[model samples]
Target: MSRKLPIVLGILFCLITNHSISQVIKEVEGLYYNTTGDLYTGTYTEFYESGNKRIEMNLVEGKRNGKITLYFENEKIQEVRSYSDGLMDGTWITWNDNSVKIAEATYKRNKKHGKWYIWDDNGVKRYEMEYSEGEKVGTWYIWDENGNLLKERKF
Candidate 1:
């Protein structure tokens, strides 16, 4: 047998075994439970129709507690978010289908609490704002499509 054949076979075996180990869970009262009626705590994955992973999130005691990643149908990363006790608690970022960053923000306990930015589809920054505990609290800037500052407003 060729040396490459062993590597290929090993990868195929891993994929098959990995797929078989995934368990389906149910949500009840906003918490996830496994088939055994126990709190589900593991990597939860959702797949696109094409068998690609659309979302992957980590759960601890049925609560989201880590980084969650979402992918476009083409398998590119579309968004990434951080959570703590099922609440948004860190940096969140999103990208357009073309792989350009479109938006980014920081959150604390599900409330906007830091800098936020938004970009147009063509990758030009369109907005820059700040928040404190979900309330706007600083000067906000808006930019035109050509990347020129259009307006600045103070809160």
Candidate 2:
């Protein structure tokens, strides 16, 4: 039937397209890398044994050069960070297994050079510290979950 021919052709087309798209995914024993290595440079995507995405990052000249994202076994995002010339240069955030944010910090050239804040599992501020050139050079504050200031120390 003429109508049946069209339907079969459409289905064939879809199958072929999907197959080609899947083939584009670079495959490894336990990871995937980008095709056209020149364009992607040294970027890679690592996977868990169950085939879940574990980490994705960009690299240039064999060093981390851009944004990186890591995922937990449950496929929840565990952390996100940005790098410049292989050094952490911007905001970095880490999450617990429950997908709750545990800590956030800023860095410059791999050194903790700015504010860092950490929270407990209950979403309570645990401590806040300031850093200068990788040294704790400013005020550090600790607080209870109930917002009670426990202590403050200055360097």
Best by TM-score: 1
Residue pairs that clash (backbone atoms under 3 angstroms), model 2: none
- Clash counts per candidate, in order, are 0, 0
Instruction: Name the candidate that leads on lDDT.
Output: 1
Question: Residue by residue across 78-131, what tens digits does model 1's lDDT show?
Answer: 999999998999999999999999999999999999999999999999999999
lDDT of 1: 0.90
For residues 4-92, could you state the per-residue lDDT of candidate 2 as single tens digits? 99999998996685555444446444234445543234556666766677888876654677889999988999999988876888899
What C-alpha lDDT do the candidate models reach, one value each? 0.90, 0.80
Please give each candidate's TM-score.
0.84, 0.72
The candidate 1 region of ten consecutive residues with least summed lDDT is: 17-26
Question: Any runs in candidate 1 off by more than 4 Å, and if so which?
Answer: 1-23
TM-score of 2: 0.72
